[model samples]
Target: MLWDWGYALEILPVLGQAAIITIEATLLGFAMAAVLGLVFAILRMLGPAVAWPVSMLIELVRSTPLLIQIFFLYFVLPKFGVTLDAFTAGVLALGLHYATYCAEVYRAGLENIPRGQWEASIALNLSLYTTFKDIILPQAIPPVVPPLGNYLVALFKETPLLSAIAVLELMQTAKILGSETFRYVEPITLVGALFLAMSLVSAALIRQVERALGRRFVR
Candidate 1:
């Protein structure tokens, strides 16, 4: 078998296109995580009556493997007559799986907030909405961004699992190319490089956000 640079270059175009699928799944999943995490965080903060169910759900999701969740969504939903495309199923599973972790991140951020701040909110007669939005969220969210971003990057890496359901992504493209060509070295190595490059780029961007938050946090 020839170790072919031409072979590697040829597959890049196909992998480049499939990388979009990975990115879309990652971003959409993060979007869901961000919102659901916030909701869970706030619900928990309010009181046990409001918090217990969401907390239980977070635990349930966290205890389950993401691969299992993805498989269930892809295979089981059809029984209920709910149809989902591979991309949607992949993203939804990724989102739901990560939301549990994101909720914990949010919980940590909220906990890091000074008890004095809550006392201050209480003393001021500020409405709950105003108190959370104006004070707690502003303080909590910035610190949580880096952690959340890391989860998003994790989600990005997990997109390869979508191949199980035939959602075309970078790794899937590599598999296809390898199957057709019988040369895995080039295609598989390209997939690794793509994941590394994307993860590095995303980490750098998140570092910027973290630095910006640092300035605000210190002030």
Candidate 2:
């Protein structure tokens, strides 16, 4: 009665499906964050006119709570006739919220590059695109991979918040299972185990990436 193995087995498939949704949202959201972060970082480097506004936007996002942002996207946006489904709203919220932190990470990476590198590129008459693509990003991005990977793991954990908007991620699925069977222990414990397993796997992958980058850049 304390723990129903049979019930846990029965619910495993459903939870697995829901876990896939969580993973999908995390991946999609992190991809958006990575791209947007890089763009924001690059734009901020352009001039005071660009950097000031971009800095304010990044600060605004970082200062606010992600749950409120999620609610605004899912609940309030419908009032403006720009409606999004629960999953889309959740993924967007996650992406936008995390992108601010990622922007800071990228900015730090870019700033760490030596001033001489920029001068060298300019002296060589390299186009801005060529400078960044061939020289700057190759140096800036590798150093930031570990931090970006940390954000990826952090974003994955945040997927449980999607339940607030009925996105039916892992936590929401566990909650539904608990309510239906009146058995909270098995479902909730399993959800914790699943999250832990996934986090460890993600950490391992991040380390592998770091090693590979180290080798590539070591010359």
Candidate 3:
């Protein structure tokens, strides 16, 4: 059969559970990536001494394949007296891998802030923290939200990689179902639909946020 609604319906609950896992990993990993990326960007902007090291680290991460990073975190870390469960390892690997991209996005946004703003902050005797918190980040972060949202969607799709370490996410569930029943159509199609639906929803939400930020900053 080209399609089987009954099997699709029957397998949905399992996939639903797996979908929750995928969502969890995406959210936690994206949060880590966002924060870590911001830190990386800030360090790079601090001075040449800090920038050089952080720049090289970001380059190293960006130069490497994410699958290798994931494998290293899951399979290799344990030998060094550091061990993580599949879910934790997956989250860390995803976060660290994408952080390089997020760092560049953040750097672009930061660089877009006018030099006059920095000089004005200094003239007003604003502390470095105050300058960044009150003036710079507020201006920088909003413009970058759309790109970060794109990363969120990309990270959601990347959750399939978690299955490599047995995190039991959506794609893994589909693979198991296909293997057991020897019918790939229903399970695979449903998984694809789920991903599509979630991606569209995420994009819509991102657009909404962008509009809200535009209105707020425009005021």
Candidate 4:
């Protein structure tokens, strides 16, 4: 009676559909974070004139709570004629928040590259684009893959926060089901189990990526 198998089964499909939204938001947000973070890292390397403002921006984002950022993007920005729907606002908030962390990771990775390598690239008369794309990123990215993957998992967990904006991700869907059926036990339990399973799977995939990158870089 406490756990209704019939009801759990009934709501499974709906939760699964919502899970797709969660996954989509996680992947899209992470992709944006990864790319934007790289740009931030590179820009910081450009010069003091550029790095000062970029550093300030990164610190500001890192200092704020993600929920506040989500609310600002979803609610406040509309007042400035920058309206975004729930999902878009949520994804942008997730990306921008995490991108600060990702930028730090990238900066560490880029700094680890040898000064000799930079000298060699310059000696070879390589363009900045070629130096970064062909030489720098290939070497820098491999060492940082594990940390970036950790951020991927962290970002996935953060998707639940998107529910605050009524994005209908997995947690939001589960909450809705609980309210409609007045059966919180089944839906809430299922959501917890789903999160655990997904986190474990993501960890495994991260390990695989780490190993693959290690092998490639070793060669």
lDDT of 4 by residue, 69-170 (tens): 999999999999999999999999999999999999999999999999999999999999999999999999999999999999999999999999999999
Clashes of each: 0, 0, 0, 0
* Model 1: residues with Cα > 4 Å off, grouped in runs: none
Could you estimate the TM-score for every candidate? 0.94, 0.98, 0.97, 0.99
Models sorted by TM-score, best on top? 4, 2, 3, 1
* Model 2 stretches astray by more than 4 angstroms: none
lDDT tens digits, residues 38-154, model 3? 999999989999999999988888998888899999999999989999999999999998888999999999999999999999999999999999999999999899999999999
Candidate number that wins on lDDT, 1 or 4:
4
Which candidate number has the best lDDT? 4
The better candidate by TM-score, 1 or 3, is: 3
- Taken over the whole model, the C-alpha lDDT of each candidate is 0.88, 0.95, 0.93, 0.96
Q: For model 2, how does the per-residue alpha-carbon lDDT over 1-219 read when each residue is reduced to its tens digit?
A: 788899889989999999999999999999999999999999999999999999998988899999999999999999999999999999999999888899989999999999999999999999999999999999999999999999999999999999999899999999988898788999999999999999999999999999999999888
What lDDT is reached at residue 145 by model 3? 93
In candidate 4, position 94 carries an lDDT of 95
Ranked by lDDT from best down, the candidates are 4, 2, 3, 1
Give the better candidate number (3 or 4) by lDDT.
Answer: 4
